[model samples]
Target: MTNKLSAGLAALFSLGTGPALAAQPVDWQMGFQPAATEIMTQIRGFESYTLWFIVPITLLVLVLLIYVMVKFRAGANPNPSKTSHNSLIEVIWTLGPVVILLALAVPSFNLLTAQYSPPEADFTVKATGYQWYWGYEYQTDEELSFDSLLLQDGERADAGKEDLATYPRLLTVDNEFVVPVGKTVRVLVTAADVLHSFAMPAFGIKIDAVPGRLNETWFNAEAEGLYYGQCSELCGKDHAYMPIAIRVVAQDKFDAWLAAAADDVEAANRNLIAAIDADAKSVDVAANVKN
Candidate 1:
């Protein structure tokens, strides 16, 4: 009887933390941002662990429900146990949940520490929110800034004409935040004007960007994909227009993009210098002609 009781308790404990309580992402929508990183992976892991407990608990409850229905029917065991004052039963029931909770607390604490612990980041990016657009800044590189706006319906149709298509419409942006896959990206979030929240559901990261204040978060995507998000906080009338898009590519692709951005800056500078030289030449010719 003791062995049977032990087996039952073990089964009950396992049932308490089982599959039904596993944590899953919202859904399998075509995600663009990135894949499970250290933080998100740990979160998902804990969720699965939590589900393990929930599954056995649910099964135990279900079994008890069915057992009560059949075993306590009027035609079956008509008389129920009237001894409700058993001190041992009371103590056992009271301590059972406490023990279960203690068991859960171990993994729960480990996961929390993993999620919150600061990692040895590889790069830092500042994500600033404007009225209806987002600005990205690379901390290590100067003049690495650009605005990301939402593509119009016509633009979306044009993008579809390309070979590889991104997320449909729920979260697409004209300019995407580009990063190298498998790199630790430390994000420093701030708002240019009003309050906005930088949220990417797949990454399990959401931080508020407030004016004059900076909030920080980090994620390292394992896979290369376009992930989308929006300014969750209602800042103004155009809050809905704000969308966040991220493109995680290979390291070589990231290097090429950086070079492209550098070339654009250089070209703009060259154009400005040429225009200044032309103005000076014109002034010199006019002065010589007058003399």
Candidate 2:
């Protein structure tokens, strides 16, 4: 137990010291991004749970196909039995799938409930999707709001984020959606022009942003860092350009950022970025020492 706790703490520290950019897909990436929230952990767990059913069933079907092809070949069995429908086999097949579905449904329902059932949200943010960008409004505190535009290639140097590690191409934004780590942040999603999807893989959240209707989703980030996502829905020609960047920070930092952003967004962003860089450097130094 002690070792496990220590290893968990080490992993969190590593994540803190890691890249400043939000979680993005790597070249030749296949699986989901690293889970930074309880919901994402549950999502990964449910994925693994379903895999147990999928893998064995797929293998069973493959083995059966091979056996039938080899054992009942034309050369081996010249006179084939006209067994069209066996009651026993039919019952087994019907009951087998039912059992499997029931097994899957139990966890599936639980996951759905956990996903939809938002615990009393600490704060709510309204995300309004535009033609190619996102506008965030802190509904709880009307004083804070900003538009998150994609950082273009030419703007990277001006933003002091030339390195891909600090701000990834097409994924980085001018203003990120900031939330405190370990807090349940309820996001109300909508669109101004067309349909869009606000998806954050690490948080296991993907909700549609309809023009007239509002969709809600929540995520409580366990680790403090940046987590990235993009608009999943195909809204327009520049749909791919709009990316979602979220910065999860400690509670005190979040409070300070909120206060500063309420006054001046640009200055607040600069301060937040500097603080994050310093925090990452400190964590890196500690990790190096422990090594």
Candidate 3:
């Protein structure tokens, strides 16, 4: 029974921290993914602020509705009050919404400004959306370029990553967009064919990929891990299959990966997977020690 209880607690803990473990949507996930960047943190804060207003307002309206239904029933009040309008109530309702709007507007505008006004980028990457895939070009120094395609189930099995933990269904890709952690990355987003949206939920980035027009967005991921997104816009029949995977690593690891990828992408991916596995094992061992 003790062992069973411990296992149950562990499962619950894992469920609670699932979003943090992977920057992808999980079953029964209602809120945003664990924030990986400063913009996402601000986004979450604004959401919380809106929720504070929404919850109380909704509850108050509900209570008022219940009170009116109970107190103003036909049997309770035979003579209905002919009062059409209360000036004080009207004034309060009008001014109350205005105040709420103003409160919301301040933060909303600030968040928009922060998101649009990116810091001087440490590096720039150009993302071009295709009909069924994404192409990434490192525009800074090395001028490395590659196309990322969604990895099929069979391909995942061939890569020996059939487990959902490693290669999530419909989310994993052949080539992940790699970047260094804690550095501002400006992404110039465009499209070669139909429209697509370059979105990363954890990074709070979602910009349109319009053909012949480059839309810019930026993110500075603070943690090193694998984050997943998808083409948010409906481009074609295979829009669902166009997955976006980003791997944030340390500067040295990124440098090595970039160099290797420029030479041979397959070898570089294998090396990255090995390094990720090693890092995961070390973390697990440290957790076990603490336990």
Model 1 Cα lDDT, one tens digit per residue, 166-248: 34454566567877778989999999888999987667688999999988888887765556677899989988888887666
Q: Is candidate 1 or candidate 3 better by TM-score?
A: 3
Q: Which ten residues in a row have the lowest lDDT in candidate 2?
A: 13-22
Model 2 scores a C-alpha lDDT of 0.87
Residue-level error in angstroms, candidate 3, position 10 = 16
Give model 1's TM-score versus the native structure: 0.66
lDDT of 2 by residue, 222-243 (tens): 8888889999999989998999
Q: Rate residue 60 of model 3 by lDDT.
A: 98
> How high a TM-score does candidate 3 get?
0.88
Tell me which residue pairs clash in candidate 2: none
Q: List the residue pairs that clash in candidate 3.
A: none
Candidate 1 wrong stretches, greater than 4 Å? 1-34, 62-85, 157-165, 233-241, 262-291
- Model 1, residue 30: C-alpha shift (Å): 13
Q: Per-prediction TM-score, please?
A: 0.66, 0.91, 0.88
> What's the alpha carbon RMSD for model 1?
18.7
Best by TM-score, which number? 2
Q: CA lDDT, every prediction?
A: 0.68, 0.87, 0.87
